[model samples]
Target: MRYLTDRKRAEGLGASKAGTEHHWYMNVSGVGLTLLIPFFVFILGTSLGAPYEEVVATLSQPFPAVIVGLTIAAGMLHFRRGAQMMIEDYWGGMTRKVMLWTVICLSYLVIAAGLYAIVRIAI
Candidate 1:
């Protein structure tokens, strides 16, 4: 029983389980964005040089629209998580909680809006 108690105390001072999970998520998102950025840049560049209808047509593709929507959602979620961590680390009092919640809510709203726009274009 004493050994278990001591182990728990030691674990408490170390990196949290949630912190590990967050790190994993952030790393995964970073890798995804690394691959996605080039594709997005190429697509945007081509679309910009094209005419207006061409732009619409390009975005109207189901696959590209879905990819864009997923990228937006993932990026927003990653940002929210990161910002929440920063707030928790640097801020104190009620302001930290408020800012964290605000960031979460705004992230969800942005993701929803992006999905709506993607669906509208795809369909």
Candidate 2:
């Protein structure tokens, strides 16, 4: 017979085998959003009271367009994951399932609309 400690036996029996991976993903995305937010805000803040054509021109440039696109993608993904974690922690059963689905769909919808707007501006 093989010998094993209780801790060892319980190591892989957590709620989900992918929990650690999700944790690391959340941490990394958190860091990414942290760094990107200031740059994005600066870019956006500068463009804020400009004329419509000027604002469009500013965002059409490659640098601003790329930064805004990355920020939108990262922000949405981070939001979705964070919301999922919160709902899972504070909810149970059907509520958790329906809430998770709603959050995921809403995040994707927002991301898609943001990307479409950015593309239209850039092009």
Candidate 3:
């Protein structure tokens, strides 16, 4: 007795392929997030109980500033990709396209804001 019907087997798990570019993007983002998370946590942990000026001063260091900026940028990209994937999965038709564009715009805005803040603190 066959478990899957011939038509079901032919469909082949819908249009989404598991081992495609989507998987690659997720894998790369996962690795980047793993590295970025620790740096972000460290920054937050060290900044705790510190005054605003002190926090700014700490970030002003070239090394810390660069690390923080890179992490923030990577994080934004990761978030954008994940959200886009989810939107595509759950939404369809014009709504899906709108949501995708919205995610893209939001991600860009977040990255821009982060970069601006980092520059202000560092410089």
Candidate 4:
């Protein structure tokens, strides 16, 4: 009396309940990056090829410094999530676990280094 139909089993769900949350995080970060990238490019571009003093002065300003800082933070987070998802889909077992950890570590490293550099210039 316990042979459930395919539809009945399918009604519940699969592995993770947090897929939607992850999806939204990815989408939101993507949108943030979309807006931030142009500003980041503008800030970086202006400083490019300029004298070291000028570039340092430009980044020292509050506005441009904040823009670069936010861009790096958001971009690294977005990269981490996307890479984790990709590695999960393509890898398995220990390999998948190691890859996810490695990517997360690298993302944090980039974020910290970027903020440190920006702060050094801005201050």
Candidate 5:
């Protein structure tokens, strides 16, 4: 017996089970980045070209530290999802799998490194 509704069947989930989820994630992340980028830019801009100690002091403050951390995490995760969509669209077979894995790893590495640097500064 068939369990799927017409809507579900029409969504064509057999080939890609996460189309809607991926789109939703991308949208959410886009909104998050929109909200975050201005604050992030302002913080970085204020620190730009300052002496090393001043830069450290600025970033060490809780608000700037938290903003930077959140921005890094959100941006990298958004990038990962977008890159996955691109690779899936353009590449095929093992190449697609390899590219996806590479993108995922790179995105996470960037997020980890950014957060680590923020923590180092804040502490």
Candidate 6:
């Protein structure tokens, strides 16, 4: 028979296995968003309130297009993770699963739509 302390026995069973991973992901994405948002805002501000042709021309430039794409992708992924965490915390059972999947799909859809718009504009 093996004798184990209670703490040892419970070491890995008391929490979600991916909690640390989730937390790290959220922190990293938060930092990335912090850095990217400023540039994104600047790019957006420059394009905002302009005529259609001017907006398209500004976004068509490689730098602005790439920045917008990155911002969209990162922002959506970050939003997905954060929303999942919130849903998991406040929900349970099948409802939790449904909400999680719905949020995931919605985030992806938004990302795809945003990127597609950017591509069309850039091209």
Off by over 4 Å in 1: 1-17, 48-51
lDDT of 3 by residue, 43-93 (tens): 868988899899999899887787788887888888888898889879999
What TM-score does each of the candidates earn? 0.78, 0.84, 0.78, 0.85, 0.87, 0.84
Between the candidate structures 3 and 5, which one is better when assessed by TM-score? Answer: 5
For 9-98, candidate 2 gives per-residue lDDT tens digits of 655666776666677788999999898889899999999999999999999999888889889998999899989989989999999999
Compose the digit string of candidate 1's lDDT tens values, residues 4-123: 764445443545546556776899998997777777777667878798788879989876776677788888988998888889899989999899889999999999998898788667
Backbone Cα, N, C clashes tallied per candidate? 0, 0, 0, 0, 0, 0
Q: Which stretches of candidate 4 lie over 4 Å from their true place?
A: 1-13
The residue ranges of model 2 lying beyond 4 angstroms of the native Cα positions read: 1-13
**Per-residue lDDT of 1-123 in model 5, one digit per residue for the tens?**
889776576564657877766777899999989999999999999899999999999999999999999999999999998899889889999999999999999999999999999998888
Regions of candidate 5 where Cα sits further than 4 Å from its true position = 1-14
lDDT of each: 0.80, 0.89, 0.83, 0.91, 0.91, 0.89
Put down candidate 6 lDDT per residue, 15-85, tens digits, no spaces.
68666567668899889989989999999998899999999999999988988999999999999998998
Q: Higher-TM-score candidate among 5 and 6? A: 5
Error of 2 at 40 (Å): 0.2
RMSD values for the candidates in order, in angstroms, are 4.8, 4.3, 6.1, 6.0, 3.7, 5.3
Clashing pairs in 2: none
Which pairs of residues collide in model 4? Answer: none
The lDDT of model 3 is 0.83
Shift of residue 90 alpha carbon in model 1, Å: 1.7
Q: Which stretches of candidate 3 lie over 4 Å from their true place?
A: 1-19
Clashes of 2: 0
Flag regions of model 6 displaced more than 4 Å: 1-14
